[model samples]
Target: MIIKVRLIPTTGRNEVISRIGSVLRVKIKNKKVDDDAANAIMRTFLADFFNVHEESIIIVKGAKGKEKTVEVRDKSEEELRKIMDSIP
Candidate 1:
């Protein structure tokens, strides 16, 4: 499924908030909102947070901006919500 996210980079701490359906509000510390950094961070964060493979997370939009649309190809909505809720 696809998830729309508004990422807040360079925050004091990192977290994810899920208020809207299939959308995430994220804050990542010391991260740049660029192609390489965003892709790398998205991969790492998803893997670490969701216990999923890096390949499962894809950036469908906002690759160069803070607001992003991500594709989680291998996860169900309930599974994704569990991961989001698990974020610190």
Candidate 2:
């Protein structure tokens, strides 16, 4: 599923913040990088969180900004959606 997740890059401890309404707010774990700040980390975190391969998640938009459109491959989309739907 293609979803927009707002990312917050902080100094300590990575965490998935609570979802409020249609927006999924996430605090990105801080990681110093040569390129984009922790985009890879975010992908990896989501992949592990959703129990999917890193290749299965794509940053469809906002690679350099806070709000990102993440594409979780079909192999996990249904599973992802169900889990997301269960969230308040």
Clashes (backbone N, CA, C under 3 Å), per candidate, total 0, 0
lDDT of each residue in 1-88, candidate 2, tens digit only: 8877777767776667778765677666674422275788888888877778999889888887777788888465567778777655
lDDT of 2 at 36: 72
Candidate 1 residue pairs in clash (backbone atoms < 3 Å): none
lDDT of 1 by residue, 1-88 (tens): 6777777676676656544655677767645765677667766776666667888888888888877888776768889777666544
Predictions in order: lDDT = 0.71, 0.74
TM-score, structure 1 vs. true: 0.72
Off by over 4 Å in 2: 31-35
Best by lDDT: 2
Could you tell me which 10 consecutive residues in candidate 2 have the lowest summed lDDT? 28-37
lDDT of 2 at 1: 82
User: Of the candidates shown, which would achieve the greatest TM-score relative to the real structure?
Assistant: 2
